[model samples]
Target: MDVSKEAKESLLVLDKQDGNKVKAVSGIDDAGKLKTVPPRKEHEQDFLKIDKHSNILENFFSNFMRQVKDPTHFEFFKIKTDDVEKVAPVIETMATQKDTASQEMLNEYRVEPSDYHKEQQGYKPIDESRIDWDNLKQFGITREGLEKSNSLEPMLNYQKSPGLHRISATFDNVKVDTDARLAFRETEDGRIALAVHGVRKQPELDRPYFGNNFSAEDKHNLLTTGNLGRVLDMKLPNQEKPIPVFLSVDKLTNELVSVRADKIRIPNEIKGVTLDENQKAELRSGKAVLLDGMTAKSGKEFSAEVQVNADKRGIEFKFPENQRQTQRQENGSEFKIPQKLGGVELSDKQQNSLKDGGTIYIEGLTDRKGQQYNAYVKVNDKEQKLDFYRWNPDKAKEITPDNKSKTQVEVNSNGKTNEATKEQKEPLKQGQTQADEPQQQQNKPRGMKM
Candidate 1:
């Protein structure tokens, strides 16, 4: 018996809440990947005639969806049995087509939309004779610029532009900055369809972003190098269970997005450039790296600067030639200064001291050897990341010590105290060598806050 030919894909359903439409589901506990699928009982076959009517069925599902009128997110919702019930009849028709010879298909996308929904949300026809070009003018993207980039045709069509675009549109009215993909998806209904893929902010450790939760270790590794370092089982929006995924920071948007562990297909040769292990690791970490000597589909060799964008949820090619002008524009803008390092949040005094670009000795970091160690850490503004060193650099000033931990390690392990710090009544921390201010000034006397 040939197991490969006999194996079948378990039934996959469109889940409004399953992993937010980025991926699909199989059995009850099947997280993004299909492991074990309990075979459907014999009676269930009558419920679905899967191998037929793909196009017309697409029209039915779209009409059914609008008639129900569920004002919900079509993206990023976890699929549940109840959620699957809404579209199962039409979707079941696609099953035999879905169950392929291989088990590698994981992220199942939407069925091809019907012309009704594609035109105007299943109820109206679109008028494409006139475009409100004022929308593009505010963003500094002229028709000439858009036409030059070959984005106008797709925008005129129902789908969005193929790649994520950098736009300076006024989102907050005060700020015209967001990484979004443009579409004419809802034009017939008088709506602007933009999939906002990225946002501006440092990944905050104190809270959750979207539905993805981060552990102390995940936070530390992400903030330092922008990579989660390992695969994490994270529960997404509307998902009842967690799925295994690798979390990466979008270097351009600073937005957090994850790639399904099984779906992470790193091509052996990207364009014509073959990447080794080190290059792959760098890309996985969400760093913008440059790869040279690649062949484009146009049969031309070119070099590209690339990084993982939250919009694509995969590796995206960035043109290398424009990097210098982009860097110059970005150089004057300071990157957000992170508040925590290795899972420890900085104190006001500690943070204030770093205002002038100083180093602070932080402990509790585990090295690759699994041993706890301490090091001087500071923001490397030039590289736009954290810099760690065993010894302090000459140009960096020292951050003030926290008063709470001051007395914890004042005395040496052998019970001898440092004469300079012994004279101070406030005591000294293990990492601190001197006292610079009075302790009373550090507090505002807030009630029950600590």
Candidate 2:
């Protein structure tokens, strides 16, 4: 009895259960055994081997799950696999068609060698024995000398040392006599000595010590000797004393004299006391005098009998010549006439004319004291009175003699006098001119006569 088919069918069920236990227990069985048990053949062992089957079920299940979860993944895997199979045929055809294609591509991509490496490949090593020691020595590079010196020897050698103080002297282009022959000396310990050569006056010099860098000329100048006498002994100059002078009283006012030594004396006549120089001579000749006690004379007191004629229309004050004194008085006198003493009279026509902006004229008027009086006219109406002088015929005629219309009286907006003339009207045209016709008639034919 053959159990191969049965065994193949039973494997799926066993794998679904304990697959590790089935793997561990599976093996070949003897031929004489019950025919129900199948023998494991060589091909069967290859198919059922656990090593070959390792992770194969896991991969297949993962692929199946991926296909079920993402349809695009399934399609992409299928298309990529098909494209790979198509690409293998294309690569094979290209390989068989050209042998140089691969060689040409490799040659085009290969990096070329560098110039420095190429030159280095042909270079020879330098010879050490041919170097000149003499030239190296000039540069202070000797082997023993360089070894003995410190590493910072050059820096130490070029370092600057401390300096000593020195005195610099300059002289103007004059020479001094040195017959006296002064000598001076100084030491580093601050010691000094001074002497004079060939001086029989005193062989031993008694001068003070001035250390090194001291000159005999400097010592002589500091000692104040010989030609430096006047420069050192000079004194400042003195200021002058102010003088006193005499001045006249008249000159004091002229500003020509400032200081006075004596009391100012004025003469009894005081001739120069005139207001100006041109009157000075006249004053001196006694033609003019300063009248200290002058007084104005008192006016005379005279009385005149005034006659006043007053009525309802007007009033007048008069002094009759017969009543006035004919003889002149010893003292001057004055008489006054009041404006209210005279009253004005207006006729009905005159009043109406004044109210209608008319002007009045008076002639041959006389005043009291038998004197001829100037004539003046005034309007009394309120509106007419304001500009009465402006509309006066005499005043208007004086201003505009050529303008006769201004002299002709006219009524104003205030019922007062006005100088403006009435505007003249323009005359009508002779025939039916455009302006003469009514507006509606203007549209009709001009051929029709008026």
Candidate 3:
């Protein structure tokens, strides 16, 4: 009784008895519209007041089926892929019960691709578990090596790893080092096999990026800072007009990353004071702006400069310490770099390297909760401060939201499965990471996309 209002096509109920032969009571007519047979003599009274646009649940359908006198009739309904989960159960109960009708209904709908889609070549996903992980031992690599370097997941998903890797292998009786990434390809024998990406000497930046032509300055900005520093209009394939995008470079791989600029929603207020249109525009343009009368997390007065950073794909604070001159970053003649961070003492050599704008891996850095974790640290020489990243920023830039690996277990690409509703005969709605249910028996339709 509770169905989505978006439901359009109702189930085509077919019932007839001809002794072991399946009698067709409804089918597609000459005009391609659904044609259902007229109700029999026993149900004529209920059909008299029913109109084409009527929702028959309240009275007509409720009373009409009980009048059928067929002793051994069977029912079948052609349900659509989307509406099956919502309307099928009601049909099942009514069709099977002896007091309701003299028959049972078998769901005839199965979830295979439509004929038009299957006629052409279709992509079939491979099960990664069937792969032989020990095959990489020849190259002195193991499954653990691929897992640690973030390459295993992509290969399992039939994609190339985002960044290149250095591995030692032998060829022509000579051992040499090679830089490459991993992928999976379907063999002629229909088995998933390992593939290695051939490397180019450099990235091909000559081609247009989403229909946006690159200038000399644009190339320079990307090469120097890894960010384009501003949004640009970019037209994607099949799109009529260009959309605004924040562009950056994956430094390790040199692949360009473009995120939709308009998707970023800036809050009306930050800390305490509301920002005007001018300040918001400055942030969107990737320019830093200083704001006063703001508050810090410790309930103290603070003021800082904030700007949009493409690498992080969000707003970041530049001079957030507290009550300090926000313009000091511009003139750091008297500013000094720290010798230690988060109470972890640095050796003189490491401190000097940080002062010289070098990145170093640091461990034993304590958080507010007293938990210690390792991090990559670099000197923000212009800001006279240190910056920390959980992963090396050079390699991490390639792991964007658009390029993230979909979790291996889920079958539906557009939507997720919910484990709470796993046993139900319904499809998952959207954004669920777990399946609606597991298939305990073979060849049973779990109502989930396989």
* Top model number, TM-score: 3
Residue lDDT tens for model 3, 84-192: 4454455544444566233323322311112112111244455867777676677656778678656687677666665565556788777756556667788999776
Scored by lDDT, model 3 comes in at: 0.51
In candidate 3, stretches whose alpha carbon ends up further than 4 angstroms from where it belongs are: 1-207, 223-225, 251-254, 268-274, 285-305, 317-450
lDDT of candidate 1 over 1-450, digit per residue (tens): 432232222223343444322222222222322222222333232222221212223343344445534424232111222333444443434433445622212223232223113334533333544555676577655667556556677666544454446666556445655455555555567665544455456766567745556688778877765666666677667898777776766554566767776555553335535566678776665555688876543344566666654435556665444453343233221444456654578777767555546667777644322334466776554334455665565454443223333323323211224544444444344455544356434532457532
- State model 2's lDDT: 0.25
Off by over 4 Å in 2: 1-344, 364-450
lDDT of 2 by residue, 132-238 (tens): 43544433334353323321232122211111111112236332222222223334664332222321332111332211122454334223211111111112235
lDDT of 1 at 81: 29
Task: State candidate 3's TM-score.
Answer: 0.32
Q: Whole-model Cα lDDT per candidate?
A: 0.48, 0.25, 0.51
lDDT sort, best first: 3, 1, 2
TM-scores of all candidate predictions against the true structure: 0.29, 0.11, 0.32
